[model samples]
Target: MIIERKQYKLLEKIIFEKLVIQAPFKIPNPMPDEACFLYMLEGQINYKTENQNVSVPQNESVLLKCGNYFSQIKNDKSATLHQIIIVHFHPKILKSIYSSDLPEIFKKPSFIDDKIDLSHINNDFLIQKYIENLMFYFDNPTLVNDDILILKFKEIILLLCQTKNASTIQQILSQLFSPTSFTFKEIIENNLYSNFSLVEFANLANLSLSSFKREFKKNYSDTPANYIRNKKLEKSTELLALSEERITDIAFDCGFKNLANFSHLFNAKYNCSPSLYRLNLKDK
Candidate 1:
């Protein structure tokens, strides 16, 4: 439950926001084209990305890149009420802020790193002081003006550059200016065996579910379900024939949910149980 919410805008863009809420808070964003710096002033939160989930503790903060995100309150029995402040960085805002002089930090790096989209920032002395100073304006909302807000925004960027995670933050911020896109086939081949649903795959591809299905059909000439299942089964058979691992492990590695389902599907496709199939391969 949201007890209270306050926000300050820059040219009608939400530049900063504060929220006070009760437990059971959940936010599922399909995609975000801007970066955010979030501070947990009162309680913990679990922010999940495609690759990992992070537990953000009270008084700490995190810097997240532009990507899909799911966030929920990390419950503490004694504390049901939580407070948080988020500072947003939109491409247009960055461009407006640095129109006269672009910072070295925003320049493209010589080498790019892996596509890990989350960076946890521990609220050290400098950052903690910055947060405290900003809260004063939040307390006396009238004291805040556009110039002050812009200065504060610039202040945080400099502070982030000073932090040990500056390189990672640089990479994240760079993406805001120069966004990257993945090829459709590259997206499919990379995530085909993982546990992501079709909708999630569509979100990753930046396409609607219907369009994703259409593209899948156009490129592969088969439904996503049929193609992925057959591919998984093919890998499972190779594992069964070559490896001495447990069938359950092989099933999971190849992306089936459970042994019974794997056996049933294998039987349906091959007309033979996995156990018998393995035995026949061993005998041969």
Candidate 2:
């Protein structure tokens, strides 16, 4: 439950927001087109992603790439209530802030290898002070104006550029402006390895669930679940036969969160467990 909420906007777009909520509640980032910088004021949060979930602890922060993410606020006795500060980075706003000359960081590719949609920033004094200043605006809302808010938002961008994860941050921030367009099949193929829910896959494909299903069937001739499952299973077989990776690791790599489920599917598909399959392949 949200006990209180406050926000500041620029040209009707949410620039900064502060939220105080009761713990043990699920929260999803509703904004799909813009990335956000989330600072943990009171408690921690875990950003659910395709590959690995990223945790933002108290006094720390995370920069998420533009996408739908689900999060949870655990009921930790040490911190019962959760307070969060969100700074939104919209592409239109960025272009406006930089005027005709956009920053080079937004143009250059970071060539980041991890490809994780979220980047974690370690403890930084500048960001901590910046959060404190944001709290001031939250406390003194009446004094804020659009110009000041824009300046404050720009200040955050400058500070972010100075952070250790500047390249990765730039990489995420860059995607907002020089956005890449992927086809429905391309999008599905790119993220086929990870374990994403059908709804999340729909969001990635920029379609409603029903529309996504219809389009998927038209393009792939199969339901999303069956296609993704068979694809993941196929990848597991290739890895099991070729790589020295452990069965457990292969399960995770193939998007099965549990070894038992991977084993069951592997047995049903290949007529043997992953371990045995690898052993039999070695003998051949």
Candidate 3:
């Protein structure tokens, strides 16, 4: 059966878009005022941020906050197609529907701390059934109208709020609707302990790679690689001097992926390997 792209204006604030993916593809999309709930009916998708990457497998779902980010989708090796159903809606609609009706448990947070926000809802059989039914409607558009679609969207939202992952989902919604502000330095300092690559950092800052580099230089007076490496090694030295932990563990805690790389950078920064540096601290 030939699958045609189908869309429905469920409400003034909600839209449903159904698409299929056969080959791998990547796209960058700025976050609209509306958050998107993506259901992977039949393929795998890798959602990448500046700091994290999450894979949504077939029959699973992931909710994306309203933020600029990138998405890559690839069909399974044995599968013939990857199907996706995305519900996009403004935060206002949720507020109008549930703000007073929802319990305190479902309320959005006033503020969220700076951290990696990429997460997915675990296996939900009910949501799976909902998406299965949604695919039927996509196939038979005549069965769907504004009222039916609105009910479907509301059902999904209420079901989501009742899931075990409700707190996380609420946090994401809070961030989407009421985002906090952070200066460049604050963003860098808070994320130093994270293992995000440079590209990821840029994405998190909502800056293009070159622009991020320019701004980072203006703020820190150093290149990103050099500044971050120095800071990581500096933190490693503090850990070495203050704790009795093994050097390899310390290396990982400082965001170094391998002992050798940590050792090399440590020697370059302090003129001694991490072990030797700790040994010196002990001698003192």
TM-score per model over all chains = 0.63, 0.64, 0.56
How far out, in Å, is residue 7 in model 1? 0.4
Candidate 1 residue-wise lDDT, 113-205, digit = tens:
756677888867898898899889899998999999999999989998898998888878888887655678877775555546789879878
Candidate lDDT scores, in order, read 0.80, 0.80, 0.71
- Quality of model 2 by C-alpha lDDT: 0.80
What clash count does candidate 2 reach?
Answer: 0
Better of 1 and 3 by lDDT: 1
lDDT of 3 by residue, 5-115 (tens): 668873364478787655344333334344678888776877766656788988788887655344555333523577778877566666665666654533567665445
TM-score: the better of candidates 1 and 3: 1
| Over 4 Å off, model 3 | 1-3, 11-14, 74-80, 95-106, 179-284
Best by TM-score: 2
- Tell me each candidate's RMSD, in Å, in order: 8.1, 7.3, 9.6
- Candidate 1 backbone collisions, by pair: none
